[model samples]
Target: MSAPDPKTPDDDPLVTQARLRRERHERWLREGDMSIGRRLAQIGVLGWIFVAPTLAGLFIGRWLDARHGTGIFWSAPLMLLGLCLGGWSAWKWMNSR
Candidate 1:
């Protein structure tokens, strides 16, 4: 890249300064995007997302099991498995993004 025209700075000094600051801040944020707390929160959120269906199944299955007498025989477990699969899928999706 060509050196900055120090003699005249950029065509717009304020715009240049803002651009430089934004780049620097982005670098800093990227460097620290994931800390222990952040990681824990991420895990918590992912778990919640994954388990939502499971919990819903538990309730709905229980209700249906009582109404239909199936005991949610498969829904609960299936939903639990979905939790893990959902998390894995999310990871894959994020990586692709």
Candidate 2:
């Protein structure tokens, strides 16, 4: 009798499915356009990215004011700085591929 044909796991149906999925992902990356869900997720991420630093600055400034017995002097400046920095960061992130 003839011998059986040799085959690798790459020939399996599961492997074929996985390969197709990977190809689709690569195509999506190349196209650089995402679905609405992805856009919404990106917005959420960007919002957090902008808000985190502002919140952190506010907390730190508040702590400093409490420790130094100062008014909103420190807090106001720091908060504004944080706002500018966050805006800059978010802008860069949005522009990046």
Candidate 3:
């Protein structure tokens, strides 16, 4: 096979710049420098994670109240417990990284 062509600084500027930009982006991703949009999305995910269990508890408690004829007695405590559990779960997720 013939020898490969030598590369020089005189390479096309556009190609060089594109390659450099790609490298920089790869480095940023590797370094875990998430973009603002991505960070916001993650925050949204965390918010959902924190809210789902609480809402579920509320609904379930409401069902129990309807069944057992109890007022806020069951709903209130369950809601609080769900809130605490969700908060703990979210905290663990946030800190796990």
Number of the top-ranking candidate, with lDDT as the measure? 2
Candidate 1 per-residue C-alpha lDDT over 1-97 given as tens digits, one digit per residue, 9 for 90 to 100? 9977565546778889899889878988888556799879877876776677567756665676678777668567766766666677667746653
lDDT scores of the candidates, listed in order: 0.71, 0.89, 0.88
Writing each residue's lDDT as its tens digit, candidate 3 over 5-77 gives 8877659798889898898889988897778999999999999989988998898888899899999878988
For residue 77, model 1's alpha carbon misses the true position, in angstroms, by 6.7
Q: Tens-digit lDDT track for model 2 on 54-92?
A: 988888899999999998867988888888889999999
Local lDDT at 17 for model 1: 87
Candidate ranking under lDDT, highest first, comes to 2, 3, 1
* Candidate 3 backbone clash number: 0
TM-score of model 3 (CA atoms) = 0.67
| Candidate 3 lDDT (Cα, 0 to 1) | 0.88
RMSD of 3: 12.5
Ranking by TM-score: 3, 2, 1
For model 2, what is the error of residue 14's alpha carbon versus the real structure, in angstroms, after optimal superposition? Answer: 47
Off by over 4 Å in 1: 1-30, 74-89, 92-97
Better of 1 and 2 by lDDT: 2
Question: In angstroms, how far off is 85's CA in candidate 2?
Answer: 0.8
